[model samples]
Every structure is written in structure tokens, then in C-alpha cells.
Target chain A: MTREHLLPENDATGKQSVLDRYDLWGQYVYGFLLRALSSPSLAAELTVSVFDAFREAKETGLTDLLARARETAVAALQTANELRLQEATNFDFRMAQRQSSDDGLLLNEKLGKAQSALEPKCKTILEMAYFNGLSQKEIEGALNLPDGSTGTRLRRAVNDLRRVFALN
Target chain B: MDLKAYMTSGMLELYVLGLASEKETREVERLAEEHPELKKEISTIRKALDEYAKLHGVQPPEELREKLEKSLDGPPTQAAVSSRPMVKPAHRPRNKKFQLGWKHLFALAAVLMTIVAIGMAVLAFDYSDRLAVATSTNVELKEDLSKVSAELVEVKKANTNLQEKLGFLASINTRQVRLNATRRAKGATVLIYWNTDQERAFAQWDQLPELPEGMQYRLWAIARRNFEPLSDMQSVSSPAGDIHQIAFVPGASSFVITMEKADGPDYPNLSRMYLQGSLN
Candidate 1:
């Protein structure tokens, strides 16, 4: 579904109604947290928390929703002891098989391909920085890279993905 | 700086991924305001990552939906539909007026008396309803007035504090001392404004890492060959907005900040010193 379709419209009382709109993007949010957290239960709990905060703030746009989801997930990752398990596992760039037969499959398929095409090192840096919420220095230490290489690798990976998407 | 080169510097990617330091984040934001292309690039990176996350979409457990619904306060109830008031039918007089006997006249008079009593009762109910509404409105106005008065007091207090800060900072007697981060905490810095005339000092910092549980930061003035405590132990999470007033020593040669146990330390723990600066 498009971003516009996911926005909660105001009801007769002039308050934004979110439940139905949430249904449209709940899986998208859950998937994000699930991959970042690797625990269905923690992801679900944070998913609920994100939506709870979103509704209270009466946020209108899709970008705000996604940003909030990322922020909430990052905060939870910091406090959660389960991150040690995530750290032990090797980084994988390939997207897991899509479970939901949703309408955004075409767009997701293209995105999945672009993500999988990234170099292994690039993928590892991106996942560590974005999903694991590690700082550039932390990623550098973890990967045994030089002090300033994490940003360079991340930029290359993102540019590669952007180029691939542009070709499509 | 060349816009194209700056765009390719990977700072925007780090920013979008939230891997950039606070200083870098601020710089990126400031540049984005000057260059629309930079803003657009940031937006594009953010969208790409968001979509990548979306590609991994896994439907949450079915039971979770029910649980979230139960947890949330349900959508607000629809506004109560108001029904239009019924209009009274107009009274019509009969074309032929028959001569009335005494009994008929007596019956007519009793009916008219009952209608008048009913009208008076309706009027009394309507009057009482309006009076109740007015009373409620008066109470609300009083509450609003009290809230505004409290807010006014707070504003005035803040204004006074701001004026005092400005006055101190503007004084020629005030000397700014820069505290460089020590090896214990690299990249962290603090500034101290000491007004020699008044022997009062204030400290400010950009950001500081969170300390371990039950640990707090204490300031020390290295003066007269003694480490004198400059302020009470401060929590790392304390707000950075207000300029913290620190005890100023007249002949202090330097200043030091160290992390110490929340309760036990009366003097600086030299090994835990995080920042230091000399008056010279």
C-alpha cells in the first residue's frame, strides 16, 4: 500500500482514527522490528508501543510512523539483553521469504533484490549500523576495520542500492 | 565546500542510519537547510532504507492484533445525533360559533386553566436548565483564570533567571575557561564561566555519556595545593540547558571533573578525572 493510504483520517469528532489505518501498516512495522530484534515477542511488544506512541502524538505522515518505529526499536535494543545473541550471529543480507501475501509484493521484491545484491561487507556494516543500532565506531571495532572505513562502506552500499533501484 | 562532494561524503548516509555523532548530525541539519539537494538526498536515503526494511515484512501473529486492540483506548464514540425540536401546530378558530350553555362554558374554562399550568411548568424547567449551564461555565472560567495566573508566575520567574544569566555572561569581569576532555573520556568537553569580581562560576557542556549506576559527576577546584569540592555530585542525566553554578575559588589554578560513587566521595577521585582545564 502507498504511504497516503496508510495515514489515519480524522473522524467526525476531528480526532485521527488509527486502528483501521494501523491494520494496513502493522505488518510492515512488525517485520522491521522483527528483523532488527530477532525475537517475535520483543518485536510485537515494541510494535504495540510504537503504535501507542504514534496515536498519542496524532502523527499524520508515513515517514513519521517509520521514524518512530525505528527509534522505538533502537531504544528497546539498547536496553534488551538479547542483543548479545544477535551479536553472536553472522550478518546476512538476503531477505527472508515474504510471509504475507500483501499487495506491496512487487515493490518489496525489487527492494529485496537490491538489498541482496550488496557486497557482504557492505551488508554487514549496514545491518550493524541500522538494525543493531551500533555507532560507526562500534561497527568499526566489531568488523576490525580502520577508524573511518565504516562510513565509507555504508555510503557505498547505499549508493549501490540507489543505483540498482534507479535502473529499475 | 562543493555540494556534490559533500553529498558523496557518506555523512548523509550515516545520518539516515542514525550512526552519526550529535555534532555531525547538527552539521548535516545546518547544511541541509542551506542546500535543498542535501535535504532531498537525506530523504532519499531514508526512503531506501525504510523500503529495504519493508521488503522483510513478516505478518505478525494473529493474536497480537487482538491484544493491541484490547490495549488501546478504542476510537472515540461518534458524536450524539441531535433530533430537531417538534413544532407546535397552529390553533384555528371554527367558522360557526354556537351559543354556549352554562355547562359548556364551565368545561371550556377548566380546559384553558389546565393548559396555562402546563406552560408555566415547562417554563420553570427551561429556566432551571439555563441556570445550571451558566453555573458550570462560571466554574470553568474560574479554573482557566487560575491556570493562566500560575503560568504567568512561572513565565516571570523564567524571565528573571534568563536576565540574570545574560547579565553575568555580558559582564567584562567574566572569564571563560575551556575544559578539554582528558584521556578518560575522549571528545567530551566543558566550559566554565568565572566572574572574578563576584567569585561565582557556571559550567556548560554539549553532551556527556551516561555513567554507570550509582555513579555521579563531581566538580573540583584545584586551588592552593588542595582539591576542593566545587559542587554536589550531579547525575549525568541532568538537563544540559541550565548553566550549572559551581563554587568558585579565588586563587584556583585549574578545574577538574571526575566520576565518583553517589554517596562516598568528599574529594576528587584522581583516577576517575574525565576533564581538566587551567585558568591560564
Candidate 2:
């Protein structure tokens, strides 16, 4: 879908209609949480909580909604001790094989290309840390990398991703 | 701090991903507050992550909307209500026999009034103290704001300079001419970015030898067969590291830099030539 279709239009009054925004962005927030938490049920629960909080806070922007959803998901993961290394590994596989048509979501072409251009290990490290919320030491142990290498790898991966993005 | 190194260190990505340690987070926040470039970089990282998240967005189950609406429409739970500060009951059940007499009521009113008076006095004093503290904080904040504003001005100036240089380098019409050092100055090279479209040129050098006192470097643009003297002579003690803008003579076949006495005629001294480069 085009961005115009994905984004909610303001009402006649020119102010963003809250329910419209929720409808438009709810799936994206859910997916973000699901990616982070790796559980459909937990992701669903937090997605609802995120929207409720967003409504109560009178936040209309997608950025704020996503930020709140991320925070809520991360807090839930921390509280439930749900950081699963296996799930992160699976996520890496899914990311590699993921296609825009699979989800019927408007994937950002630039970011998708940039992400796909990353080395497998670098991409996995990013997924483990960003999506799985694994600490540097946890990532090193999980990947069997030498001590202090996780940070270096993570930095290089992110830098590479940024460089690729800049190039494209 | 080497901002380029810090920016590429990936700490910003980690920070944006909410994975940075508390100390690292603080450092990033402090630096971002002080440096506009860092702040811009942080913003870019956040945007990239946000886009990445959006790229992987999945359509939630349809039933999820119903669940969200039900929760929104439902009344607050007991736990939710209990989390708020307790409010006194608007009315208490009356007992005729336990009612107070007029004299008791008057005495109670007097005591309540005394308590209220003391409470008001205490509140007034607290308010005054808080007001004073707030005023002091406001003054400090103003000072900090002014300092940040000054720093912002300087950063903007630097940013403009960098942007101009980048623009010149990126322009298709701009030609990069490397001026090779002559026999007098070995192992020295200068880069000149000449923008033909804008008729502007900038020169940069790394290791040009220091000239003697009262001697300066002059630039000449050779257009056709005639030499045009470009304004802005560079002294050795001047900022050699900075990219210096020079007059761009149109259709210049070549350029030359020569060292001459500070008081010498405004012309290139062929014998004192230090570097030369041709457009061809």
C-alpha cells in the first residue's frame, strides 16, 4: 500500500482523528511488539495496552504510538523474563526469508534493502540485541563470540547498515 | 571528543534501541544536548529503526480490535481505581443519637479554624520557599539556555561551512585539481575544488612548509594566456588547515601558488612558485 493509504487522514477540522490513527497504525504497533516479545498473545496484550495508553495520553502521532508500544513491550518482556534466544534465532531466519508480499504490509524498500545487505552474523547480532533485547554479554555467550566482540560487531553492523542506507 | 568516531561507534544505535547502559545513555544524552550533529545523528538512527520496525509490521488478528474496544469501553478495574489516591466519602451515614450539640459544634468549629489557619500559614511559607527555589532554577536555566544558544550559533556556522564544502565536492560541475609541489617543496600537495558553475574555488593543504617572516603565498588563475591574481594571500602562520575560498577565474587553463614578500607587487613570482596544476 502507498503511504497515503497507510496513513490516516485528518478530519474536516484538520486535527487528526484518534480512532482513525489507531486503526491505521495498530497493526504496525502489534507487529513491532510481536517482533520484540516473540509471542503473539503477549504482543496482542501489549498492543491493546499501548493503544489504551496512547488514547489516555492524547498522543496522535505514529512515532509516539510506536515509542509507547516499544516501551510497553520491552517492559513486559523484562517483567515476564521472556527474552528467548531461540526466538531471536528464528527471527533472524524469518527476516532473511521475509518478502513484502508475505505480510501484505508496505515494507520500506530502502530499509529492506539496507537490512538485507547486512552480513548474516551482523544481522543476527542486530536482531538478537534489538529485537530480543539481549545484553552485550548475553549476545556474546549466545553466539559463542569472544568477549568484547559483540559490541564491536554490533557497532560495525549498525555502521554498515547506515553506510548502505546512505549509499542507496 | 571525536564526533565522527562516536557517531560511527554504534552506541547511538544501541542507545536508540534502548540497549545502552545507563552510563552510556547519560553520556549520549549529554553529548547530544551539547552537539547538534550528535542530536541529528541520534534522530537519524531513531528514524532508521522506526522504518525497520515498520518494514516488518504484521497485520494483527482481527479479533484484537474487538479486544481493544472492549477494554476501552469497560469500566475501570478495582485495582486501577485503587491505584489512585483515596477520596473521602461525600456523605457519611447519619446517626441521630450521635449528633453533636450546638456548643460542641461551636467548639469543634473553633478548633478546625485554628488548624486551618496554621495549615494556611505553613502552606504559605512552603509556597514562598518553593517560589524562591523555582526562581533560582529559572535563572540557572536561563544561563544554560544562553550558553547553549551561543554554542548553537557556533555549531551552525561550522555546519554551514561544512555544507558548502560538501556541496562543492558533490557538484558535478566541480573539478578537483591536485596541485603538485614543485622542486622547491617536495612531498607537498594541495587540493583545489573549483566549481565552474558557481565560479568559486576553495584550496586545502596538509603539509605546506612554513614561509619566512613577511612572506605569503599568492594564488593565480591562468585564463587563456593571461594570469589573473586571485584575492586572499595566505600567510604561513594563518589557518592552513582550513579550506580557503579563492577567486575563481573563468576558463582558467591552470592555477599556480607562489611565495612572495608580503609587500611585493600583486603578481605571481615565477621563481618563487611552490605548486602548479592544470585543468587538462
Candidate 3:
């Protein structure tokens, strides 16, 4: 049998969090940059960028850190160690994609391509919400939305994005 | 608690897909805070969608990565912002893929456990089989050893007889006599025994008739004054019965045979005499 050891959640704060630990954040950002760039030099550079962004937001009290901390997917993506999370993400994404047209795939490659082609604003919001660890509440505060409008806008934006991604 | 309303509101699925606006996100978060099932549904949807995204994550080219890296390092590298995603895989999409489920996981575990159990059973069976074979072989070996021991005893008896005969060959006077069963006519014969220095009387009865039931042959020693028993004898079976004349009491010197009860009498049953011999 495959003896897989499931690890405990790594949220140091013990709250709903995605990469709440800095070590994991560094690993994931570095991994993303490495896979996307496939060069150590570029990965190192992007590592600086992600942390730099984090620091800049923190210094200014720009609500971005809270945005990330309270991000909608914090709970699902949390892991016990930076290395395992990075490895799992890298292994699953890098190795296991279908290539043929008639393999009966679930995700729409065309729509995926289109979603990635979206306006920089939409891309930023979704990626920050998904990968950059920004929360809708923080986004609402950042955008200066009325007290109750942030969740509605986020939901509407996401549904639109999903439809775009779903379209063949 | 308000699952029905929550469902019709389409808040749960949208929140799960990360579709809710900032304020809507707060609302859903608040509902999740109050109701565990809502949180549960949220977690499940997020997990499924997250897995889906992970399966289809973008792999930007090394060149694009380099450009992005360079831009992040210093200045933005200028390229036309194309509408197409550079990282999009060059392939068509597929659909209706089934997910791996808990039942499959449990089934796999059960099969693995069964395989282990069967392996143990086979090993135990082999061990028992070996034990049975060894025990039977051990018993047969013991039987063979006992038979060999009995044969060794007989060999010792024969060896002593040969040694006595060899002594006769060394003596200055060597005498041998032939005798017969008186009533047998032609069926029974015997040999007068020999020993060095008059050690003792000895004989070998050769051929004797199969006796009728209720009768046996005996030996007697005849003297001028007394008909005394010399040796113990009975209906003979083997052609070569040992006549090793080991020391007898000083008083008895003659030998004879008679028909008596199965057990011969201590005194000569002269009335039932079948064979007679006397020593000078």
C-alpha cells in the first residue's frame, strides 16, 4: 500500500490562511517563478519581487497583507511545510496534463488561455485572491467600497471569470 | 440552518468559486461563522476547484520567465501585450473526467490487507508441512535403528560359535560324532557336540519332525545309577539351534530326548522317550 503521511495544517496563526507562514510563501513564490521562468536567476529575482510587494504593502498599511491573509481560499491551500506544498503544486501541475483533443478533458484549454488573456485588473484580482493571498475584505477596503459592496463585486467578478474560463 | 435560502441565493457556489464581491464575501464569511455546514460546503467546493486549477496550472516559457524576471529585477521589458496567454498549452480540452473517491481508497486498502493475510497463511502452511514430513522420517529412521540392533545381537552369538570351533582345530585330538533321532528313522539327525578340555557336552540337532500337538522333545543324561536330565530341549524348529555348552551343575553329565507334554519333565519321562544319547 502507498503509505502517504498527511501532515497537519501549517497556519501558524491557526486561522483560515493560505501560506500564512512566511517560509511557505517564499517557497511557493520562488517555485512559481522558477517553473514559470525555469531559470534560477529569474526565480531569485521574482522571489525578491513577491517579498518586496509584501513588504511595501505592509509598510504603507495598504490593506494588501490583510487581503492576502483573509483571502477566500486560505483554508483549502494551507499545508504543513513549505517544501511539501511547493512539491505537490509543482509535481501535480508540471507532470499531469492531457495533450490530445479527444482525451475527454474537463477544463477548457481555450477558455483557460482566454482567462489568462483577460485585462490586467481582472488578472490581478483573481491571482491575488487565488495565489497572492489577498482577501475580499481587504480588497473591499483597498477599493474603498461601501461597507457591504465588496463581497458582491468579488462574487460577480469571479462568476464572470468562471464563465469566461468555462467557455469553449 | 438557512441552507435553502443560501442555495437559492447562489451565494455558496459563488463564494466557493471565489466569485463573491467584497461585501458578499463578508456576508458569506459571517454565514460560515454561524453555520458549520455552510463552512463545510465552502471547503468542499474550494477543494474541488483548487484541485482543478492545480491540474491546469500555467507553465510560462523560459523566455517569458526570463523577460518577467528581468522586468521584476530592474525595468519592464517591453513587449506587445498580446490577447493570447503565452503559457496556454497547445492542445484541445477534454471533459467529464471522474474523480478518485473514498470507496476506491477503502477498496484498495482491503485488497492490500487480504494479500498480506494470504501470504501469512501460505507461509504457515509450508512450515506445518515440513514438520509433518520430518516427524514421519524420524520415526522411520528409529525403526531402522532398532532392526539393526537386533541383527547385531545375532551376529555376536554367531561370532562366539566360530571362535569355539576354531579352538577345536588347534587341539591335538579332534573328535566328532554323528547321531540320529531313534524313532525318526530317516527324518531327524543330530551331531554330538565338541569342546576343548572337556569343557561341557554340546550338540547340534539337524532335522527333527514337526511334533504333534500336546507333545515336545526333551533331553536326558543316562547314568548307571540315575537317568538324569542333562540339557533343556523342546520340539526343534531351526536347522541350526545353538549347542553352546556353557557350564552346567557338577552332578549332570548325560543327555537324551523324549516325547512329553509341551514342557519336558525335569526327571526323564522315559515312557515317552523319543531320542537318546549318552556321553562316556
Candidate 4:
């Protein structure tokens, strides 16, 4: 791998470089947010928010770049969750809305149940990656798992989730 | 190299999940670029995940799309391009991979050929050295054979001479005479094979010790009338059983042998007499 391949094509013009990054990774970030948030509007909003934040960061590493995007999306999701809680002042109204949202909430509920139903090790690994937002390397280090096996555990967790979802 | 093994390795699934490390992701991309089947497999896996995500996708609010489009109006910043490391898909031609493979094969073949050539040269040199030694040995054997052949001829000649002497001794006119040892020459005895008809005498020096270096034994023919010296004598080089011809002596009553100086005097040295016998 050459240095040119590793580095961004042009780093001098920070403006155009940021736009290029948004163009390239915006869809991928949106896709990941859609999976995590299960809401296209929120995913799109978070995707834009990630790029807006990425424009200011000086880190050149690609992994760090993706991490920044994930952090932005996760933080936005947390803020939305806090806002939802705050707005739940009317208990009867909230209950009625929750019942109505139950149609869309079924898949989310099923997915969450599938994650929880996974083997303890797989559950922990998936939780670390999705909920805690730890990288596979971080998961390996934190769990004292051997190198290269974190990916294996993640793959297994996803497969197990698929099976659990299918069984339901 | 085993594409099936690579496909089933679970690494591609991790890549799709974005759980793969940067290095592993790059490796997957590199291998997928190199192998179209792997690339197709990656695409299939991505499509499956895409379908799954889309099944649960919700339509975004129209205002968010508009806002995202407006956000892209500015010039490309360093962070934008650098944020997602764009991997330029490498075009690795099959011919290039084939060329590299062939180059390694040729290099291995060249080394093996050199080793074989060296082995053959060593064997040839060793064989040549052994041939030289064998040739030298053959030459020596031939020379020895020739020497033995020459010696065989000399032995045949000696045998013929002995046969002739045996024929002469078998004649009826040949007298076999034994000379007795005298007091001064104890243990000295000789045999005389005399052909009286031919007046020829041959003497055998029997039990004769080797004389001193500068002395020799002489033969003398004695008669009552005169002390007649017959022939000069010396240590014989022939076999001990051989009979040698002396001077012709007739009408001699006795024969005597004596030790004398290497150059014998005309008169016999009586004190150095070695053997005496009467011709009775």
C-alpha cells in the first residue's frame, strides 16, 4: 500500500476535503444510523450532524474518522431518548401513543429481544459494539479475548440474532 | 489462495457489520479486488444487509434531505476527504499475478538446475580421477606381466641346460666319483662326474662353505709324476646341486681342491687344501 493510497487525495483545501468526505461516507453513515435508530429522518439528521462535526476534526486516521461519525450519531440518539422521556409528562396520552407506535415497535422489540436472547458471551460482545460503541479491538482488550476473535464473536452474534429473529 | 476458505472465514461478515478493524477491512478489500468471485460475494453480502436495513427503513422527513443537500454547498475540506479513507480499487491483472508466479518458478528451477549441474560435474571429476588411478594400476600390472614372462624364458633355458647334463651323466662311460673331506677341510665333500671316454671332468662342490671375500677355491689334478693344476675355481652362482665343467684331465691318480688367493698361483698351495680323493 502506497502512502498516496493511505492519505487523502488532497489535504490542503479543508473545505473541499470535508465536502468530499460527506459525499463519500454520508450514505454509509446514514445506513448505519438507520439500523441503529430505525428512523430514516433521524438517521439522515444524524448523518448530516456527523459530517458537520467531522468538518472540524483534525484526526487523519480513517478508523478515527468512522468513530467520530458513530459517536455523533450515538450522542444524537441519546439526546432524542432524553427528549422523549421529558415529553412523557401525560401518562395516559403517552400510553395511548405507545400503543399506536407498537406496530413499528414490534421489529425493534423483536431485535432487542433477539440480542438479549443471545449466548452470554455473544450478548456481551454485541452490547459492547452496539450499545457501548466499543471498537472490536477495544472489545478484545476489555474482555481479554484473543486478537482476531472479536470479529468472529460479532459475526456469531449477528448470526445468532438472525436465528432468534427468524424463530420468532 | 483458497477462495472457498476465504469466503467461509467469517471475515467478510464482520466487514459488512463494520466490526472489522481497519487493517482487516483493507485486506478484505484487497483480496476482493484481486478475486472477482470474492468481490461478487462481498456485494451479495452487502446487498443482503442492505435489504435487511431497508426492510426496517423509515422515510426521512423532506426537510432533512434539503438541509443535507444545502450543507454540501461548501468547498471540499481536508476533513471531508480524509474522513473516509477512499480505497482506490487496484487493477491487478491476472497476467501480472501469473508473471510473478512464473518468475518464482523459474528462479527455483534455475537453482535446482545449478545444483544438478554441480552434482554432475563432481561425479564426472570423481570418475575421471578413479579412471586415472585404474589406468595407472593397469599399466603397472602389464609391466609386471612382461617381467614375469622374461623370467619364465630364463627358467626354460636353465631347464634345457640341466637336461643336457643329465643326458651326459646317464652315459655308461661316465664315472660318478666322490671326493672325501681332508683333515683341514672337515665337512667339505665333492662329486665328480667324469666321462673317461671323452677325457672330460665335471665337479660338484658339495657342502662347500662360502670362501672369504678375496679368496677362491681352485681345482688341481695330481699324479705321482707331476703336480698339475687343472682349473681356477670360485664361488658358484648356479644352484648348489649343479655340476660345472672343469679342465680335461686324464691319467690322474688323484684330484684335489684348494682355497687360494683370487688370482691363483701356478703351483698349488698345499696348506690351503680343501678336498682330496684318490681315483681308484
Candidate 5:
């Protein structure tokens, strides 16, 4: 594609209708697959399947995805921004400790509300992915942050969260 | 290989968490698919986590998976598996088998050829669809772009019209005639618009103290031999911008303006000719 084509163009309604067009089903299958697979390449390939499933689902399965999204979106409100912030910071300090390798299992235990060991970033990443129903595109659109920043932050957040529980 | 260290890295957990970057995700996927042991390790970790989350039972509310499945055009996989009829391949009759020879080889070749042909056809069809979509998208965008381009030209045309009118107004040199205060009237100003090129006149009046209960101003454009009243005045309404422009001044010698009652007469009262100016 030419550079000019990549440059932003406005749709008559004063919006980028093209990118928004992908959200037609708003399954945000791309984001779902990204979170589900955790492997970007796998996620992308599955992205096609999600759409393919979506395309085929148009006749049959689509109602389910939409219903699921709605259900999840409503339940999403329970997770707060304050919780998300705390989860990220707690996760990081643990990772920095160079602690034992059992952090993953330990992190799991701490994930319950009873444990204050949760890192703010980990909570943010989870909340961002699950509750907000934001696609990477939406996150990029809303935050103007690089796509990689989210992944990096997520990984770092997870590591820190694990460390707080001190799994290793 | 250090499989233990690799598995211990804890990256697989994030992989399950779906937190990896595209590049990182791609690398993890490539590594998992390429290495069976790594794939097994990752799946093991995921299984453990999935089971764990399941115990907590987000249940994610009723209709969550159903909603997800609907969007995917796929089923709740668990439902798909459980709902499907079990395969009974073992119970099927032992079908007759042809001994492998020239016939089987030809059949194999034809099957391979057919598959290749079908794949090519699918690729061609997909490409055609992509092209059609891209072309339509381009056409839609181009129409909008052209509209944006047209705005600049429209603005330029409007600007030129305004500039030309301003220049036209600036070119004319004009003088106004004033009459001294008389029995009924005081100070007044009239703006006369003259088109030098067309040799025409337009006139309006302002800021004379309000007229008496039934009086008005009458205008006459006078030539050397004859006189014609142009605009007869009504009482002023608003303080400004309410002045009325009188249309069409026939070829003029000079002008005679007078004061009269609000209802003006066909001919000026010569005595009421408050002001007069000549062609010379």
C-alpha cells in the first residue's frame, strides 16, 4: 500500500468507518484470540478463524458471540480501576525480587481479593483485556500507546504479580 | 535441550493469559508447534490454569460461551463435542479393497490433480473477492477526497467574489449634498451609491431627527429640464441598517430633496425643497 493510503482519511460521518467496520460483529475476535492464544502468531491465525467462524456464524453462531460479549461487558464493571492499578505495582516488585520460580502458582493464590500482593499492572492488563472488551486496535485507538507496550506491560505485570505471591 | 529451564521460564503462563505481543505470540506459537515437548509443556501449564479458573467458576454468567460461539460462527466447543454423534468406524462392515497397481496409481494422480485444481480455484475466487472489496472501498474514499479537494476551489471562488466587490466599491469617488435645518427637519446624512461604469445612482438616508407626526423626506433626481422624485421616506424604525436604498436613477443633471408629510405628494412642494445640488 502507498504511504498516502495508510494516512488517516475521514469518512463523511467524521469517523474512521473502516476500522470501526471490523467491529461489525464486535466479537473483537482478534483481541479474544490474542488473549486466548497468548502467542501473537497463533492469535493472528486464529484471528482469521474467529472471523471465519464469525462469517459462518453469521448464519448460525453469531448470536452466541454477541450474547457472550454483552454478558461479559456487564460483568466487567465489577473490576475497578483502583484494583487494576494496585495489581500492576504489586506484580512488579515481586518480579524484581529475583525470587523463587514458583511465582505463577503463588500468584494464583494471591489473585483472590484476600491477598494484597496483586500487582496493579497485572490487574490492569487483565481488566483491559477482559472487562473493557478493548481490541488491541481499540486500546491503541483510545490510549495512543504502542501495541507492544501493552504486551510488555502485561508480561511484566504478570511476573510481578507472581513474585508478590513469591511462587518460587 | 534445557527443557526444564524453558518450561520453568513462566512465559507459558502469560501465553495462556493472552498477554504476549504479536511478535512474542508469534514466536511462542512457532516454538510450541515446532517442538512437541514445548507444546506439551505449554498445554500442561494451560490445563492447570484452566482447571484452576474453572474451580473458581466464573461461569461468566449465563449465555457467555453461547455469545462467544455465535460471534465465532463456531459452537461452544464442549457442546460441539458432546452433542456430536459418536463415530462407529470400527463397527462398519469391512469394505472390499482393490489391490494396488496401475489403476490405483492413475486414480491417485487424478485425485491429487483435482485437489490442486480445487485449491487454485479457491485462491482465484478469494483474490477476486478481495479485489472487488478493495475497488469499492477505494471508490468510496476517492469520492470523499474529491469533495475535500473541491472545498478549496469553492472557498477561492467566494474569496474572489468578495475581493472584486470590495474593489468595485473602492473605485467610486462620491460627494453628498446636505440641506440646512428648516422649519420641520434637522441634521441628516444620505449614502449615495454610484456605479461609474454604468452611470447609475442608488440612495439611502440616516440619522435625521425623527420626522413630525405625519411628515417624511422626499427625494428628486433632477435633470436640466425635468424632475422626478426617487424615493419617498417613511419614519425610521431601527437606529441603523434600516435605511432603504432607492432604485434606478435615470440619467441625472442634479438632485432636489424635500420634506413633506408622511404621505408624500406626487410632486414636490417647491418650498419644501430643503436641499438642491446641480449637475455642474
Candidate 6:
């Protein structure tokens, strides 16, 4: 949408209208955060924080605001990534000390293509579990799956991806 | 434990996707710890999911972005996130002992003074800008007023000219003559004003018959002795209240108006005579 649409019809100078226009930047911020966080809900939530920072800064202009917004999203994503790493260690998973690896990026790309090739049900389940970072129980609730079906659906999705990638 | 069976059970995928609960996660960790190969498999699954996400990340709803931005910049966040960076005081317990020293008092006073100075400067700058704008507006208004005053003077001069004409029309020496419309121009009677003393004349009328394009009415003064053509009117037939001057003709006993070329004719077109009158 143009800046005119972002602003109220009558008053473009009003602070509230300016803020309303700023709200449209959330999608961009969310997308940036999602790439780093790998979860839509978390990215969306942090997108709010990024905008809050912008408002707090009392910044103006979409170009400048979006530039600042991307930086804010990156910072929040880094914090979230640290927390996720801490969680993995807290579970005593004994994972390698470092995770932000190039090999992992390659694997994610291959796995993503395989997931996209899966059937609708498998894709939906896998997306909720992997991209949305939802627990099986939460996925079941979100998808309205029958009791105990979430795990079966998740395994089927993973197996489908494995087949596509010729991993099994 | 059947380590090979556990590796193929898809539990690693659940753990990698974060779909495993705290208890399930703990179990997975415990088994992966006992078997290094199991840990490697869990790591591989997690890496795969991360790659998938990087390749196929979905953007949040466009509407949701707006909502989030609103909530961020709106009333809920304004106080906490004002434009100015607020210096947050270090967190301290209410029970912590606090002592104020002279140095502390001086520092606090200095900060307050600085804030006050900044506020006054801002106010002064704002006032200066507003004053400049007001001054410019006043200058524009003055220019407009000057233009309006000049126009008013022109209108007054015009009014005086009209008043002089009216006064002349009301003079004792002015004579009025009613001109009768001819058969061709029925209902087109006209009145003529003649000031004998000033030797000037004008004509007034309510309605005149429509003239053909490039044609006009010409008034002729007919001398009493010979009824010879004297002089034609200077202007075309004028509307009521507006006077059209006719050329002065001394000793003229009558007047006759005829239709002629718009530029007018030196002699009257007797056959096309539209109006005729005799003076008292």
C-alpha cells in the first residue's frame, strides 16, 4: 500500500495515523525474525517488540524505520537463539558447543525442499512442528487432531521428508 | 536398550522439531548421552529442520503486522518507550539503605538544571519560529489590504463620475422627450434627455427591437426649418437607467432613429425609421 493508505484519509500528520502506518512494517520485521528464529509465532511476537522500539525511538519515515526495524529484529532473534541454546544445554542434550554452522544451513535447505514436496497433511504437521516450533500437544490442538494422532502424523511427515531426500 | 530401534523410532525428529515435552526431551537426552551415535542423529534432525525453516519461512499475516505495530507504538507502550531515551535507575531493593551526600545532591541539582535549561531553549526556539511565521502572515495581510484600498479608491472615483451624470440629468435645463416606436418596432418606445444649456443629449429605453447582426440604431436630429439630418447619436441604444449620448444638434425640433450598419451612417434611412419624436 502507498503511504497515503497507511495514513488516515483526513489527517496524515496525526501521531496516531503515523503510528498506524508504522504498523504495516510488522510483516517485514516478522519475516526477518522468522528466518533467524525459525518460528512464525515467536517472530510475530518479537516483531511487536521491534515496533515498540521504533515507537519508543519516535522515529519517522518508512525507509529509515524499516532499516532500524530489521536491526531490532536481528538483535531480538539473537537473544532468542541464545535462549534456545541454553534450553538445549539445560536438557543435558550434550550438543556441540556451536550450532550456527554452514553444514546445518545446507541440511535445512535440503529438508525444506523435501518438506515442500510432501502431501498437505504431512506438510501442515511438519510446518507446525518445525517452523512454528509447536509441541506435539499444541500442534494437535491447533490442527484439531484426534487424541494420540499428532505423533503418528509427525512421524509420517518426517518419514516422507526422509524418503524425498533418500535419507532412509 | 535396542539402540538401532530407538534411532529409527522417529523420536529424534520430535525432539529436533521441539514437539517433545520436557519429559520426552529429558528421555531423549538421557538415551543420546548413553549412545554417542544417537546424539549425532538428534543433531542431524535438528539441523535438517533448521535448514527447512531457512528455505521455507512464511511471513506473518500482513494484518497481524499492523496490529503488532499499533500495540508497539500505541498507548500501551508509549509510557515505557517514549521518544527520548529514559535513563533507567539501577534496580535496588526498597529495604536497601540509602544515604545522600553533598556530592550526590550537587549531581542531582546539576542534572535538574540541565534539563530545565534544555526545556527553556526548546520553548524559546518554538516561540521564535512561531513569531517568524506570524510576522510573515502579517506582512502578507498588509499587502492584501493595500491592494484592496487601491481598488476601493478606483471604485470611489467611478461613483463620483456616475453621480455627476445623475446631477446633470436632474438639472432644470434638462428636457425629456418620449420617442414613439414605428410600425416596424412596436412596443420599443425610447426617452431622450437633452440639456439645452449644456448642448448635450442622451437616450434611455426599456426594450428595443432585436437588431440584426452587423446592424444598429442611428439617431438623427431633424432641424425644425427643413427637417434636414443633423447628427447621429454617439452610442447604440442604451438599457434603462443607462444613458447613451447623442450628438448635440442646436435648434433641432425633432429626432428620428433608423436601422443602419453597425458602424452607423451619415444620413438617416428614412424608410427604416424605427423611432421618431419632437421636442416641446
Model 4 has an lDDT value of 0.60
DockQ of each: 0.19, 0.14, 0.01, 0.04, 0.02, 0.08
Q: Is candidate 1 or candidate 6 better by lDDT?
A: 1
Q: On residues B95-196, what C-alpha lDDT tens digit does candidate 5 reach at each position?
A: 966578998899999999999999999998998799789889989998999998999899999788667545545664443333233222335555555554
TM-score, chain B, each candidate? 0.49, 0.46, 0.40, 0.48, 0.34, 0.44
Docking class of 3: incorrect
What are the RMSD figures for all models against the true structure?
Answer: 18.5, 26.3, 48.3, 52.6, 35.6, 38.3
Error of 2 at A166 (Å): 4.8
The clash numbers for all candidates, in the given order, read 0, 0, 32, 15, 38, 2
Per candidate, native contacts kept equal: 0.42, 0.35, 0.01, 0.11, 0.01, 0.20
Error of 5 at B254 (Å): 70
Per-candidate iRMS values, in order, are: 10.5, 22.2, 42.9, 47.7, 30.0, 35.2
lDDT for position B159 in model 6: 93
lDDT of 3 at A131: 47
What's the lDDT for candidate 2? Answer: 0.68
Best-first order by TM-score = 1, 2, 4, 6, 3, 5
What tier of docking accuracy does candidate 1 attain? incorrect
Best by lDDT: 1
State which candidate has the highest DockQ. 1
Candidate 2 C-alpha lDDT tens digits along B172-199: 9988898766544566667788888898
Cα misplacement distance, residue B188 of candidate 5 (Å): 60
Q: Give per-residue CA lDDT, model 4, range B163-275, as digits (tens).
A: 98888888898887776654334566688777878888787775565555666778777655456777666764324667888777677766767666667677664434556
* Candidate 1 residue runs with Cα over 4 Å from true position: A1-3, A6-16, A83-112, B74-280
| Candidates by DockQ, descending order | 1, 2, 6, 4, 5, 3
- lDDT (Cα, 0-100) at B107 in candidate 6: 100
